[model samples]
Target chain A: NAGVTQTPKFRILKIGQSMTLQCTQDMNHNYMYWYRQDPGMGLKLIYYSVGAGITDKGEVPNGYNVSRSTTEDFPLRLELAAPSQTSVYFCASSYGHGELFFGEGSRLTVL
Target chain B: AQKVTQAQTEISVVEKEDVTLDCVYETRDTTYYLFWYKQPPSGELVFLIRRNSFDEQNEISGRYSWNFQKSTSSFNFTITASQVVDSAVYFCAPLTGNQFYFGTGTSLTVIP
Candidate 1:
């Protein structure tokens, strides 16, 4: 089973562009999260969902949006990309809030 | 508000040597959880260990050990007889409820 899979391993977007980062997990976990990692910085939570149809803002949710429509998918949307939005995005799933399993990560570059 | 801190930004140790990574956290809440995660160049995060506020049990796993001191609000990890594969960025995170706060991370390089 593919534990967690993310789409578009790499992407480049111009300022004002919009895109979606797709995340899917086969574990049927109740919790899913979106995080971004900057250079020399640890992962910062962008958004999280406890279950399908439920989502909540996280520490660094200014430039992003998320939706959890099904148990297997939680997608993060960028409304207007900025240079600061260039970072590696990771999707994680867990049985609880503590221990998490992360994806390979989606590298995004905004120019 | 909760914050996690890793004082050492970078650490280097020769293979077969021992090294320790320090982590300190702050939060007003009476109960919380602390965690350590390892991320290599491959980009996936691997969870190393987790400790709650109440439990101060010092644990040893294989060649790795952790010391959790609630009084100092510190959770330290030590690697004994390090190997080249241990080179990675280690992150310390503290969690309150559903939110997790991560530190800047400590980059550990085990050189041959």
Candidate 2:
């Protein structure tokens, strides 16, 4: 059973390029999140969605955008990729605020 | 503001030895949750344990144990007879309301 799946496991983009990190969960969870982890760092929340059509910004939501059109998908978009945005992106989903099921991360490198 | 602190940035211990990873948190909310997660070299997060504010009882499962002290605002994790497979980066997150605060993480290396 694939709990949470993230697309583009690894990607490299030039500065000012744009890309979307796709995330989908099969667990029918209502809460979804996008977090970025820099090298040797902890996870920093970029955005989170409680349910379909409901989204909120977290600690670091500077250059990223997110849309939750359905319960199973929450995609994060980088409008203008920057060198500072080079990090590992993780998508997670949870039933409540308890244990979070995380995807196998997407590593992105911006030149 | 919510904050989780893992004082030890990195620790190296010989296999079969016990290791204790410290986690301290700060929050104004009286009711919150503390958790420990393990991220292996594969870069996937593995849930280790979760403790709420109401439960102060220390828990032990197999070789893993947790010490939760509310007065000190600490929830520490201990691994007895650490194995090579237990080598990973551990994170402590204190979640309050709808947000979570994660520490910088402590990298643990078990040497054979």
Q: Which one wins on lDDT?
A: 2
Per-residue lDDT tens digits of candidate 1, residues B13-110?
A: 99999999999999888898888999987778999998889988898999999999989999999999999999999998888777778899999999
The candidates' DockQ values read 0.77, 0.77
For model 2, the superposed segments whose C-alpha errors exceed 4 Å read none
Model 2, A1-111: lDDT tens per residue? 799999999999999999999999999999999999999999999999999999999999999999999999999999899999999999999888688899999999999
Worst 10 residues of 1 chain A by lDDT: A93-102
Show model 1 residue runs off by greater than 4 Å.
Answer: none
Q: What's the CA error at residue A79 for candidate 2, in Å? A: 0.5
Per residue, candidate 2 scores C-alpha lDDT tens digits across B17-86 of: 9999999999999999998999999899989899989989999999999999999999999999999999
lDDT of 2 at A103: 96
- Model 2: DockQ against the native? 0.77
User: What is the overall TM-score of model 2 with all chains considered together?
Assistant: 0.98
